[model samples]
Target chain A: MDDATLVALARSGDGDAFGQLVTRYRRAAFLVALSVIGRPEDAEDAAQEAFLVALERLDDCRRPSRFGGWLMTIVRNRSNNLVRREALRATEQIPFSARSSTPTPEKEAQLSELRDEIARALGELPEVQRQIVLLHDLEGWKHREIAQRLGLPAGTVRSHLHYARKSLRKLLKPGE
Target chain B: MVDNGSIPLELLDPGNSDPGHWARFQARVMALAGPELARRRATRPLTVGEVLASWWRLLVPASVVAAAAMASLLMPAETTPGAGIAIEEALVAGVDDEPLPAVLVADQVDEVAFLVAIEGGG
Candidate 1:
């Protein structure tokens, strides 16, 4: 069934509808959490919490068609909060990679050297810039959509994207 | 729509990259998110209905108390002390030792219409 149907059913005390809704979006929700928080466990937590919040507040959804984005925003905000807390911990740990676990050669080589480089480059970007890049390039969100979701001016979003990609290109250029 | 426009095509495409780029990303993403999902499930908060149910349970006793208070207010006052004493006294003095009090004055109770009629007849 469509998300709208599932959401409506879930609102009427149907647990099955809610379960279906969770299954359908769990992957994307996870990805969104991972990107924002950079830790697998934290991302999973954030995603699940977002889903539960969505379910609990299902009635507050003004546009049922926009439920996915609405739900994701909850995850994004929660993950961001964690990220901020960790940053305040006075350590510069990489997001999402295991703590105390060094990168293995095989794992490093799985992605093409350039792709790996680009990925690392993305990780290195400032938070807002990286978000802009990910929303535009990976998540396929339109600039306007990203602006609305991130609560930034469209021009600011475009500027962030422009600088982020340019900086990434320079950082990921051949031979370093 | 492979239009790179002014952008470099190489940035978007890695000729030697893993053939399963999307799949690999999907795996990493899921792995990273699994535990988060579990935590979220564990901490699932109460819904609106649950909240309302709890609230109603709390209100029921309050409503009952309020109703009792209102009923007490609307009821008539207890019998006056003087009237109660009169009834008890009349019961003791009456023929059967139990008065069927009718709330009558002392004059009404003392009336002797039958005695007066007998005297006139004589």
Candidate 2:
């Protein structure tokens, strides 16, 4: 079923529909939280909190069809709030895990290097650019979908994506 | 379509949120959701500040009306014929202005007598 239909059902107290919606958006929500909070456990907490909040305020959603973006906004807000509240305690780290017990040497080396450089670059990005980059590159969200979710124009999403990728490429250059 | 493939998709998805993790997360969320949903259904309790704010609205108008009533009760009586005359004004005001008309002379005497009775009583 479409998001609008599921959202409507959820608003009428359908727990199953809400569950389905949560399943569909949980990954995107996690990525959004991770982008802001920079820890897997904290990101999970923020994402779960966002879902709970979304469920409670489902009726306040003005556009149900854009539920993914709406949920992402909540995730981002919650994540940012968590970060602000724990700013002194938050240790800077890659947004995702880098360690793997077993992997080929070359692939592991590449992953290690990428994790370090990318984390620093991503941390340096403006929140909007980081969000657009993560949604587009990490989550495979299309520009139009991202635009709708972020309430930005498609052209702006594309422009931000281009600039973000360019910045990442420069920052991730070898031997820097 | 920006293809920087350093990060693997397998690392980001399909495995990070394993079924067990998803199940637990879902359960936790649903559990918290129960109270949140109930709280939304419940009426919000008003804070003391809010109660006082509402009372202030009613109190302001009621106080205004009460003050106006008190002021009216305490206002010196207008010195009209029907209104009770000011004692000082009756005793000394306009004493030399004119002689009373024949029809009003008796009434004037009665008013003067009443005023004298009040003064004596006081």
Candidate 3:
């Protein structure tokens, strides 16, 4: 079913419908938060909190059909708030010991390293470029869809995606 | 899509390699939001019928009071006993410009006295 139908069902107390929405948008929310916050752990927290916030304020959502964009706004706001709070706390970086406790399998460790490298590279890009690149490349969203959701022109979205990919390639392979 | 040859863009996707992670994430969000969702549902706007159904007990009596009030207002006012006589006496006195009768001055006019005063005045 479409977002509007799911939103209406969820509003009527259908837990399963809401669960489906969470399942569908969880990654998008997380990626959006990650793009803003720059930390996987903080991004996850922001995304989860955004979902709860969205659930509480579901009635205030004026357009149910554009639930994804609405939820993204919440995620972005929550992530920005987290950033501000973190700034107030003066915490600079996640302590290495705090990232993981148990040793990971070799393959998982390599994948984690690659993920961190990609995150660092993406961090070097402008915020809009990071968002566009992640949504287009990682989330598989079309440029037009991203434009509509972000309220940018489709050509601008495409241009950002192109520059973002170029920058990512350069950052990932400085040796080459 | 611009071809970023061997960019490993898929590696950046959390869901690509670890679907279970996202599943757990979804579950966690649902678990945390369960109460809020229930609250939203509980506080959902009442339909007109539901509102009437819920408040029918109070509403029914209130409606009765309102309707009785409206009926009373719409109906011609009822004159109290002797009120018409007092008004008629006042009108007669008013026409003659005689000293106004004491019944008109006093709070409660003695109906018999008032009739005698009216006869005497006439």
Candidate 4:
């Protein structure tokens, strides 16, 4: 069913309808949360909290068909709140599990530094640009889908991603 | 910017699939939402506990007011309101004259008043 119909049903206390909405948006929600929080567990927590809050305040959603964008706003707020409350208790480093086992200690050390630099760069980006970059580059989401979810123009999403990647490339340049 | 393929964006993605985690997460959200849904039902009556829980913020102040009221009612009237009669005596006479204590009458009054306010405002 469409999100608007599901939202109406959910507002009337339909658990199944809300559950379907959850299933449909869970990935996007998690990705958005992860973009802000930078940890899977924390992102999941924030996303789940967003869902509960959204369900409680479903009647406040003025545009029912735009549920995805509305929910993303909630997710972003929840994540940023979590960050503020926790004061970033967890490091925003992304794990480098794809590294080859045969690397020497010096090479491994360099790779670790590069990973940290990239994480710092991404973390420092504006929240919107960071989310667009992560969704586009990492999850392989189309600009159109990101635009729809984020309530942004497709061109704006592309521009943000381009700038974000450009910044990442400059920050990760070798022999710095 | 030179080729930066050496940096892996996928590493930061936190892979998009995790059925087990999502299931547990959905369950937690529903657990919270289930009671909220019930509490918000316009047609369904809220249980006493739910009502109290929902209005717990007002509980302490109301209780304090009630306690103060009872204390005031039960205390000996150093200065009677009129006819040199204590407030308790007047309430007792107004009722069935069954000699009910002034404190009980005040308690009943408080309960009725509270219920009315709740029904009126809810």
Candidate 4 lDDT by residue in tens digits, B22-87: 677678887888887776566455568989887897888899999999999999878556658787
Place model 4 in a CAPRI quality band. incorrect
Per-residue lDDT, model 2, residue A97, is 42
CA deviation > 4 Å runs, candidate 1:
A1-5, A13-28, A84-108, A112-116, B1-122
Q: What does the lDDT read for residue B80 in candidate 1? A: 64
Mind sharing the TM-score for model 3?
Answer: 0.68
Flag clash pairs in model 2. Answer: none
Query: Please, what's the RMSD in Å of model 2?
Result: 18.6
10 residues in a row with least lDDT, candidate 4 chain A: A94-103
TM-score of chain B in each prediction? 0.30, 0.35, 0.35, 0.24
- lDDT tens readout by residue for model 2, A1-176: 99999998777666678889988888788877867876667788999999988988888899999899889889989998888778656665334343334455886577555554566676667778877888888878999998999889999999998888778777666655
Residue-wise C-alpha lDDT for candidate 1, range A1-176, written one tens digit per residue? 88788877666656566666676666556556766776555666676677766766777988776677678778788788878887888578654331223354775444334344454566677767866776677656788877865678999999999998787777655555
Native-referenced DockQ of model 2 = 0.09
Per TM-score, the best of the predicted structures is 3
Question: What TM-score does model 2 achieve against the real structure?
Answer: 0.60
Model 1 docking tier (incorrect/acceptable/medium/high): incorrect
Off by over 4 Å in 2: A88-113, B1-20, B35-122
DockQ of 4: 0.17
Q: Can you tell me which runs of candidate 3 are displaced by over 4 Å? A: A91-102, A174-176, B1-4, B45-122
On DockQ, the leading prediction is 3
True contacts recovered per prediction: 0.00, 0.18, 0.53, 0.40
lDDT of 1 by residue, B45-116 (tens): 777998999999999999999999999999977856565557646666756632323223454543355455
lDDT of 2 at A155: 98
